[model samples]
Target: MLYRMVTPEHICPFGLKSLDLLHRQGFDVEDHQFKSRAETDAFMASEHVDTTPQIFIAGNRVGGYDDLRRYFHQPVADPNATSYQPVVAVFATALAMALAGTWATTGTLISVRSGEWFVAFSMCILAILKLQNLETFSNMFLGYDLFAQRVVRYAYVYPFGEAVSGVLMIAGGLFKWIAIPIALFIGGIGAISVFKAVYIDRRELKCACVGGSSKVPLGFVSLTENLMMVGMATWMAVR
Candidate 1:
């Protein structure tokens, strides 16, 4: 088999490892570093290469990185040999549930306030808990300011908005004047969150859902998980 390895600048550890591993496997590999898209195009034209890490086993184009991984690791007849499970869906669902539950419970508690002082006390407790979680998420995804800025922004803003919405929902449920608008607004934010999850997944971006037990990747399954949350939130609001 002849392997024509085309790669961008060695910017990540994974790229370097891939190159080394391919060479050690005793394939007739040619390495080309392309600094720009134009260079890549020219190289591809000259070599009749149609993809990165193009593997030709007896003059047949196998595919890209993922394909190469499967070819080397799995049997030729196993259709599902290369498939791997991703943790994104589970993580996204858990986080969304925790956030939504906090909102629902706090709102319910506020609606059934025992006294003036108790309402203030309960709100204060809820605010502190929400803020702490938000800050944790911000630090996890934002890394004090380099990448995943959107995740950080969402983390910081979402909790505060939830708190405010919770309060409004509670007030509305008790007084019967503000319930519909507040619920609608909360539902809107949930829908927006679902959209954001989808965008991140389609872009193959990393998620910044922080904390000791929350490490998840952004992927298609995660986006679907968020959509479930969106459906629930919308239903809750309407009810």
Candidate 2:
């Protein structure tokens, strides 16, 4: 048996996916839906479950969609899978955009200008993701940032600093003066923090570079992010 939810304003996507999965897995499903919010709440309360798309297999409570997946021996979309895939995807998109921009401007991807553009865009995107939920990012950041550990408020400020300076770096004028110094200071701090946390201290931590929801580890990938900022800042300062 399956109990799912659908509403006028929003339908649970997982509920639909659950039904599909059950059908594919050759389960005989007695599907049911919550006709209204009150009924949904009552059902959830009665079942003592927080979410819908719940399943019962042979009269045994199989739980939610993810739980059902586990029952079927399928890999659930677990975020803490400790893969660099998220950062890789973000960086790959940035690289593709950078190459396209370079080609558009100079008819080649080898343009001197494209390097900074790539760096700036990457930093900005990372910052935006972090800024989406400042509290969450700050908490994750405090796990490793040397200064943020000592001074908690620095965690809150870091993402905004990255975002504003990254945008300034892209603009490239008097703003470069502001952007360059900030990047160097922050990046230098970050690189050291990541190195000490992952290498020296041997801590297992999630990176806040791509934001709080990211499960990217505190290792070479995170160190590279900081190092890239430092390199970009140095180049901008000298040029």
Candidate 3:
């Protein structure tokens, strides 16, 4: 038996998770859903419980989602654990898109332009993530970014600059004069900032590269991103 809240306003996510788990474990579950907050609260009060999605197997209470996971010997996620998943996902997607687009347009996957497209695509995607919530990204960026800390407004303008640089770079280097400088300036400053915060200052902080809410550690990945921009800019300038 499984008792979970399924109100009109909000369906409890853990309840769905619990149901899926039970099914996967080959258990036939009798679902008992509370359709309103009042009923859920009253049941909770009567049972001396604090949360929903309570599971019962063969008349034995298996508790909530995490508790059920333990019963099944499954690993539970740590909320505070540092994860590179988001950044990896973004970069991987960008690389795939860059390769696919290059092949579709040029009839080949390997070319000098392939690398350029990869970096440009990465920049645009990263900028899009940061631009989703400028205020949040700005606040988090100010924590360790030297330029943003000093200028304040630079944090907000940073994403737009990245987007512009990326778009111009993708336009076949025709606007190299404009794109190169922006990429160099932003990338140079970012590299230094990340280096100081992570290597020199020995500060442990979250990266704002993906977004403010991401838990990506402020270190190598961030530095590499900046370095890619700098290298791309320098190459474009000289070529």
Candidate 4:
């Protein structure tokens, strides 16, 4: 019996745990890590395999992780019984970005009468929290190998950007024109980041958004979020 495991670096906790269980079961297992999706698909095609963690018992494909787990347990007849859903952490990220954009854009409209200072302070705090969430996501997606160098730089930049935008938001309450452009710039960057996460990266891993619910895709929600920012930026730029 040959147990083959194919997983991306730093993204497959369940797969790893399954592999460990297999090892304890005395099966000959070989683990392979792929950097990109193309490599993984090519290897799977060559091996005549369909799913990840493909197990071959005397050269017969047994199935994937769930299959193996069921085989070992044997309370169930089918080896391939499991519910493995793709993690959706992007929605939370989109929500955070959307909130930041809304807060920045509407700062001028919020009156200075009743709890305005508190509201501005809350926006600042939320902006910082959102920035922290983005930093966590950067670390997760880039991994430790490249995160320290590349991710950290962006991490620092984004929080500072958030701070600047927060200040501009406060200022907008006093002088609308001054803060509008600054808020637009910050929101524009946020939109770009969301676009990259959704259209470019395809939300394969978990997003590290700070607040709100986690586990949602970056496709519709992120694209919409970014579009809102872009629209806000364009409006501010024109005005």
Candidate 5:
């Protein structure tokens, strides 16, 4: 037996998981749902439990989702574990978007423009990530960015600059004049900061490249992002 919340606005994911687990293990499930907040709270009070998605097997209470996972010997996610998944997802999506955009515009997946589009898309996506929580990004940036540390206000300005330059780069032609310099300046500063903090100073830190709350390492990936910006600006300038 499983009791879980299933309201009009929200369905409990763990409840679904519990049902699936019972089915997978060949145990027939008697699922009980609390359809509203009032019913859920009343049920919790009656049961003397603080959380829902409670599981019962053979009349024995198995507690909540995590408790059920432990009963089945499933590894639970550790919140503090460092993972590259977020940054990897960001880069992969940016590359895919750039390729799709290139194909739509020039009818080719592979082109000289593909690389340009990729970098611009990455900049736009990363800027949006930072802008999602500017205060957090600013705090993270101050940890290692030399320019941001000295100027302070530059930390707040960085995301907007990157966003504007990225949009302008995508527009091309006349916008290159504006975009190139902006990308070059910020990228140059970022590259130097990452290099000094990680390689020169030998400090192990989290990167602010993806966002303030990102667990991305303050090393190669961060440096690569800055270098890509500088390279894109230089490429556009020479062309």
Candidate 6:
């Protein structure tokens, strides 16, 4: 395969990824680096291709990064594909940690309030994921979050609020004064925004529950996050 690599100014990340993919697939690649933008443009014009880094397999043009992926029968980008894998994995890990945490502290996983521990830990774990890429999370959140649409800053604050509430809840509801209110308030807004966007507005979108990079769909799991908060807050209030 022949590949024309770019300069530092026009770095193509997927070019590297595609090259690696080709290497793993046991294809001997002859890669060339374009010294200048003019050279690169000339190469593109000569080949009649729009983007790079392109691959040519046995004199057949394989197009750009995505086209290479397709030629290799690999899954490229599909925005419509609703992915629950990230959210499911995060929740599963959080549940395991909650069980381990409770067992470590109480010497038992099953208790009267074990559910609380699970929910608290789940929120904390999800919030931590969002906090990992706050900018990405906020950008994804702006898609469906009503407050984020209006205020914009709320998208950035949402993760912090979730993290605080989850941590407070994990402390055996000691800070019910603060935790309960945050849970209810955020959850309420989240649920309403999701309902309006997914049901009323009927738009297809990704959920920012696991963070902006996640592919979790904006419907069931999104609503569940909000409902979980409301439920946790209500339980805290009653108890």
Q: How many residue pairs clash in each candidate?
A: 0, 0, 0, 3, 0, 0
Q: What's the residue-level lDDT of 117 in candidate 5?
A: 83
lDDT of 5 at 221: 89
Q: Which segments of model 3 are wrong by more than 4 Å?
A: none
Instruction: In model 3, state the lDDT of residue 72.
Output: 98
Query: Among these predicted structures, which one has the highest lDDT?
Result: 3
Candidate 6's TM-score reads: 0.72
Whole-model Cα lDDT of every candidate shown, in order = 0.45, 0.86, 0.94, 0.49, 0.90, 0.87
lDDT tens digits by residue: candidate 5, 1-67: 9999999998999999888887888898998998999999999999899989999999999998888
Ranking by TM-score: 3, 5, 2, 6, 4, 1
Q: Record all residue pairs in model 1 with backbone atoms less than 3 Å apart, i.e. clashing.
A: none
> Residue-wise lDDT of candidate 1 within 1-239, one digit each (tens)?
33333345434343344566567777656554555666656757877767554555556666655566676894343543322222433344434444455456675433223232232223323344446666555564343222235444655664454445446543534432343343345335444543564464344334432221243444443344334333433444555
Top-TM-score candidate index: 3
User: How many clashes show up in model 5?
Assistant: 0
TM-score attained by model 5:
0.88
Give the local distance difference test score of model 2.
Answer: 0.86
Q: Compared with the true structure, what per-residue lDDT tens digits does model 3 show for residues 83-115?
A: 999988989998888889889999999788889
Model 2 misplacement above 4 A? 22-31, 37-51, 55-63, 70-73
Error of 5 at 175 (Å): 1.5
In model 1, what lDDT does residue 38 have? 68
Q: What is the TM-score of each predicted model, taking all chains together?
A: 0.30, 0.81, 0.96, 0.36, 0.88, 0.72
Name every residue pair that clashes in candidate 5: none
The stretch of ten residues in a row with the least summed lDDT in candidate 3 is 169-178
Q: Which stretches of candidate 5 lie over 4 Å from their true place?
A: 8-10, 24-26, 35-48
